[model samples]
Target chain A: MKVANEQTTRDRIIETARQLFLTRGFAGTGIAAILKEAGVRSGSLYYFFKSKDELLVAVLDQYKGLLRPILIDPVEAATNDPIGRVFALLESYRGFLLETGCRMGCPIGNLALEISDTHDEARDRVRENFDAWCACVEGWLVDAGDRLPNDLDRAELARFVLTVMEGAQMQAKANKKIKAYEASITQLRHYFEMLESRAK
Target chain B: MKVANEQTTRDRIIETARQLFLTRGFAGTGIAAILKEAGVRSGSLYYFFKSKDELLVAVLDQYKGLLRPILIDPVEAATNDPIGRVFALLESYRGFLLETGCRMGCPIGNLALEISDTHDEARDRVRENFDAWCACVEGWLVDAGDRLPNDLDRAELARFVLTVMEGAQMQAKANKKIKAYEASITQLRHYFEMLESRAK
Candidate 1:
C-alpha cells in the first residue's frame, strides 16, 4: 500500500509538471505555479523532484514517450517505401498540428529552443532525441534500397526530413494554416521521388 | 537636439529589449530588466511604448528589418537559377546558424513558441515575416521556369521550401550540429533539381 501510494504521488507530480512545462516552458514556469496547479504542497513537490531542472527532465521524458506514437509510428509503418514513408511522417505531423490548432509546437524543438544555451544536460537530451529521431529516418532511407543520393548519406536526409517537419509545424502554427505543412510535405515527397528516379 | 536624444533613448531601449526577449523570451523578460539593460528608468520605457507588447512589436519590426539583408539578400541574388537560388538560400541559412553557435533560434520561431495564447498581434507579425520570407521563396520557384511540379502552384512550392528551412534550422539548433542543416538543404536542392528534369 505504501509503494502504490508513493508511486501515485510521484506520477501525479510528474504529470502536472509536464502539462505546465509544455504550456509555459522551462524558464517561464515556477515551482509555486506547478504546486498550486497540482494541488500538492511544497514538501510533496520537493519530495518527488529535487529541483526544477530534474522535474523538467522527467517532463520531457514523459512527453517524448507520449509523442512517439503520434509523431513517429505512422512514418515508421510506411517503411516499405522510404519516400512515401517520409511523406506519411509529414502528413501525420500535419494531422496532429491541424488537430491541435497548430499549438504545442514540436516538443523537442521547443525544449531545444529554450534550453540549448543555459542547461547542458537538458540541451544534450534534446540533441539525443533529435539524433535518435534521425536514426529512425535513416532506417527508412536505408530500407529504400539506396535510391537516395550516395553522396548525401542517411544522416543528411534525416536532417532534411526533420527540418521540414519542424519548420512546417511552426509555420502552420503561426499562420493557423494546414496548407503550410501540406506544402512542405508535398515538396519533400516530390524531392524524394526525383532521387529515386535518378538512381534507377 | 531634444528629438535626437529622445530617438536615441528609444532605440537603446528597443535594442536592449530585443536581446533580452530573444535570450529570455517574452514572459521571461520584464520591463525592469529591459530598463536596466538600456540604462533607462521605468518612466522612460513607458514613454517610448505604452506596454511591453508594444515594445515587443517594435523589437520584431526592428529584427525583420535587420534580417532582410543578411537573410534574404543571398537567396535573392541566387535568383539566376530559381532552383539553384533556393539551394543557395538554404546554404546561407546554414552559415548563419553556424555563426550563432546554434543558440539563438529563428526569432520568429522563438516568439511563436514563447507567446502561448496571448499577443495575437505579435503572433500575426511573425506570420507576416514568415510569409514574406516564403514569398521570396515562391518568387524563386517562379523564376525556375517549369522546374517545379506542374500540378502544384508556386505558392505551394514556396511554402514547402519555407517549412523545410525552418524545420532544418530548428533541428540543427536542437542538435547543435551544422551538419543537420546542411543535410536538409542538400536533399531539398536535390528534390528541386529532380523536378526540373521531370519538366524536361
Candidate 2:
C-alpha cells in the first residue's frame, strides 16, 4: 500500500499517457484510453492533472528527466569513447524500433509536429526536450576534442544527428521497414568519417 | 459559372483539407473546418467524397501530383548541376520555413507521424509519397554520374537528404525559429562537400 502512494499513482499515469501519445499521437489518444491503461479511475487522473494537456506537459517533463538516466547513461556505460557513445545513442533507438517493429518514433519529435502549434505549453517543453538532447550530443563532440575538425560547429552537428534520427524514425515507421532507418544512419557514418579524416 | 465545375469543387476541397491537415494535423482537423475553408457546403463535400478519410486520400493523391510541379520543377529551373539541385531542393524547404515563420513542416511528413499508424490507407499513401520523393532525388544522384564516389550508395544518400529536410523542418517548427533548420542544412552541405572531395 505504501508503494502505491500519490506520487507513484501520478507517475504511473504520466508514463501511460506518454506511451500512448508516442504510438497513437496526442489528438488520437482518448482520455478514457489513458485512464484504462494507467489502471486508474477518472477521479484519480483528474486529481493529479487538470487536463490531458497537463498530463502531456508532465510526460514531457518526465522525458527531460529520463533522457540522461534512461537513454544516455546506459549507452555511456557501454562505451567510454565519446564518438562511440553518439552512435550508441542512435542504436538504442534502433533497438526500440526493432522491438516495436518501427511503430513509434522519438516521443518529443512525435509531439513536436502533432501539437506544437495548438498547445503552447507543450511546445516550449518540446523545445526544451530537444535542446537538452542536442546539448548531450554536443557535450560528446566537445569531449571528442581533436578527433573532429576544429571548424566543425559541434552544436549544429549534434542537432544534425538528432535531425537524422527523427527523420529516419519517421521514414522507418511510415514504410514499416528498418531498411529505411539503416540507409540514413549509414550515410551519417560516412559523414562522420569524413569529419574525422579532415581533422587528421 | 464554368469555373465551379465538379472537378474544381473536388480539387478545392482537397486543397483546403491538405492545408488544414498540414497546419493543424490530421487528428486535430475536422470536416466542418475543411468545408468552411474550402468555401463549400457539406453537401458538395460529400458529393465529391463520401467520408473525411476519402477526402484525406484525395489530398494525398493531389500531393503526389503536386510534388514534381511545385517542389522539384521549380528547384530544377534554378540549377542544371545535379548537386546544386539537391541543395536547391533543401533550400526550397528553408524558404518555406522562412515564409511561414517555421510553422508547417513537410506535408507528407506531418501526416506520416500523425495518421500513418491509425489509418492504414494514409500510411501506404505516406510511404508512396516518401518513395516518390526519394526516387526523384536518386535520379538526380544518378545524373551526377562520376562526380560522386562510385562506391557511394546513391539511393541511401537521396533518402538521407529527405531525412535531413524532414527532421530540420520538425525542429524548426517546434523551436519556432528558422536557425534550427539552417543548422541542419548547413551540416548537410558539409556532408555533400565531403562526398565530393572524396570522389576527387
Query: Highest lDDT: which candidate?
Result: 2
| Candidate 2 C-alpha lDDT tens digits along B94-120 | 888788878886889988988877788
Colliding pairs, model 2: none
DockQ, per model, reads 0.66, 0.87
**Residues B1-200, candidate 1, lDDT per residue (tens digit)?**
37535568889998999899877777778888988888999988898799999998898888778766877775666557767777777777677687788766477777876664457888888887887877877777777766655676888878887777777777766767776777777677677656666787
- Can you tell me which runs of candidate 1 are displaced by over 4 Å? A5-7, A64-85, A146-152, B1-7, B73-84, B146-152
Give the 10-residue window scoring lowest on summed lDDT in candidate 1 chain A.
A1-10
RMSD list, candidates in order: 2.9, 1.9
- Which 10-residue window of candidate 2 chain A scores lowest in summed lDDT? A1-10
Write candidate 1's Cα lDDT for A31-147 as tens digits: 898888888899988886789888877876766576558666756665566667767766676666767787765767766777776777777778777777777777777877767
Please report how far candidate 1 places residue B198 from its true position, in Å: 2.4
- Give me the runs in candidate 2 sitting further than 4 Å from their true place: A1-7, B1-7
